[model samples]
Target: MIDNEPHKTKAYIAGVNLNDPNFDYYMTELANLTEANNMEVVGQSRQNTEQIVAGTYFGLGKINEIKSMAHGLKAKVLVLNDELSPVQIRNLEKLTKLRVIDRTELILEIFANRAKTKQAKLQVQLARLQYELPRLHPSENSLDQQRGNGGSTGGGFANRGAGESKLEMNRRTIDKQISAIKKELKKVANQEDIKSKRRNKKQIPKVALVGYTNAGKSTTMNGLLKEFTDESSDKEVFVKNMLFATLDTSVRRIDLNKNFSFILSDTVGFISKLPHNLVESFKATLQEAKDADLLINVVDASDPNMIQMIRTTQSVLREIGIKNIPMITAYNKADKTDRNYPQIEGNDILYSATDEKSIKLLAKLITKRVFANYKKFNLLLPLSDGKTLAYLHEHAQVMKESYENDGVHAEVRLAPENQERFKKYLV
Candidate 1:
């Protein structure tokens, strides 16, 4: 049967394996990324070589082979698994007669398209500018022509040749834009820091949802929101069956109970081989996870590549400098498999986000883990000291409070720090 779908850019993907065991998984992720970017992958190939060619990414014979195969499949673009230099990209474009896109460029394009908010847009722009700063050609016509033989040596704005002039002008423009964006981002980050300080003053136990993209982190967050938060149902973070459906960080207060109340944040998901520029640009957006008291690494239980996905998340977490923090491996989408609805195995849980009971169990597990060290304390504050009374509610879980002639008595559960700070009020 002749099948037909809407017009999409047909792309051919290829990679060179340098004897790495994870090469195949990288290619699989590349294909998924291509599809996520609204491109149809028509063919794929790999060359087993110990070293990469400096000029052209692939050997002469392999390039010709891939060119013929891509042409036969009517592919209009060639995608590679690794980032390519300007020289390699230009050389391959000349040899294959097809537009060439490296992994970094492809990921950046997707991020640029998905960005919606001002901060996310600025971050993607910053990363794109940094990526393009080094890859700019002297002119549209020629990839070479002595683009100033590297950086400035002694030339001033008064004198420059025509080609050098244009190249230098473009570089300066991008540099200025990069500096401006960084300034704006710093302002945004300062605002975020102020808000973070307020949350810290309250001493709420903060939990962050983090995992691989399209692994249902948002869905899990929505489940918790629907069950706990007072916000309208529509206030949930964006959810779609696609990679990077949401790029912004969302923090909401989850009051599961008076004792279990805490702050929950949903952050951008991770992917294997994520670009370093993108990571550096998004560090501020990912600040929630860094400050989290606990992390939930949601995994797709039904995916055949489950193990690889878990490993990828771990690798990305380490790359981002998150360590020594408590984490739970939540195996989501268990309903897709023939397993039970919800079950906990030590720090890991097999559950489905759509199931109400599963959400409750997961919440209970989190509550247990977050508050295990909390201890009950009895305190008596003078009736005139309303300030400490109010602080008690925010800093600790106040279980009971009563006013008498001389003072106010209260029962509360406090963390170690809170307990030490309030020891003077113990009765």
Candidate 2:
């Protein structure tokens, strides 16, 4: 078979740890991010310091050491854990003789590559422009040679292929682009808002799946789709074993039974140290979760770093201002471990999404939570009120119905407001 894979750029990862305890985990995330961006991490280096150097991130001695180590590894790119100023980036490149990329840029590049929808693409573009807005310098700097590099490493803040032209874009041009993207995104967000309002009008309890990247959110979504809905492949969202696999939020109505149903939405996964601009740009895309009556925070139960991953999800949730929402800690991928499958402990569960039994149990749990507020009612409407009969069948969960000569008898589950509206017809 012909080898069809393209060449992967060799990258050396490094970070300046300013006495933080989670530094090592952050570095591991950096390496994973590098690979996710289609690069190979050849090696890594870190500096534990009390204070960062003003000009460069790492001290001069450590910088020289990293440069030597990276050169020995035959790495073409030097990836850093923190976002650096333009001067520091230029200085690092000149000293290390490799293209420099920061953590923020790496994430943006991944998002830029993964964004497929119009709204998602525009959001990523908006974030990229905002990130570059400040980094762009009016005058020429030391990256003149980067212009000749031909973007072989793919387009990014650091790997900017055909580099100088993008760097040469003045602030005014970038500002205009930012404004245009914002205007377009606003229109799209308004459309999304309209759709959300319609869903709200249905009064279906909305449920959202949220978690760290590559944590099986899409797989769980597929499990629910296949179990509750038709097994048509077109209804399933994309599933992949990589970071940020599902960028666009997917909304589908999950009907557990005639009397119970909720709108389920699978959302974009979160990552550690996600760029602030990216979060702000994605707020509209994440509105489903914000409006959700319940959230399923999926976790990779088999991964060693599950705790940190959960923390990362919580952090991003907090950043997006989502608080007091009911959340279920869904520890997925139990088949990969030695533990028993489909066990619920308080508000959390240990289950595998691919198992039919597990999906049934999860659905049961969701129904219990989402329908907890519903009130059952018995009402008699006049035979002339066919519109009300149709409305009750469509909106309320009708458990019993009958036709009488003088009126229609119905026993249904209704929300609090619905309970009050039809009180006149109470039987």
Best by TM-score: 1
Model 2 Cα lDDT, one tens digit per residue, 1-427: 8988998999999999898988988998999999999999999989988988878899999999999999998999999999889889989999888999999999999999999999999999999989987786523422433555332434465555345455555566778889999999999999999998888877788999999999999999999999988654788999999999999899999988877889999999998999999999999999999999999999999999999999999999999999999999999999999999898888888999999999998988888788877998889999998788777765787778889886988888997667777889998
Q: For residue 284, what is the lDDT in candidate 1? A: 95
lDDT of model 2 at residue 188? 95
Error of 1 at 352 (Å): 0.5
TM-score of every candidate: 0.92, 0.90
The TM-score measured for candidate 2 stands at 0.90
Candidate 1 runs further than 4 Å off: 1-6, 141-160, 384-394, 402-404
Q: Clash pairs of candidate 2?
A: 151-161
Candidate number of the best lDDT: 1
Candidate 1 per-residue C-alpha lDDT over 123-156 given as tens digits, one digit per residue, 9 for 90 to 100 = 9999999999998765542223334344333455
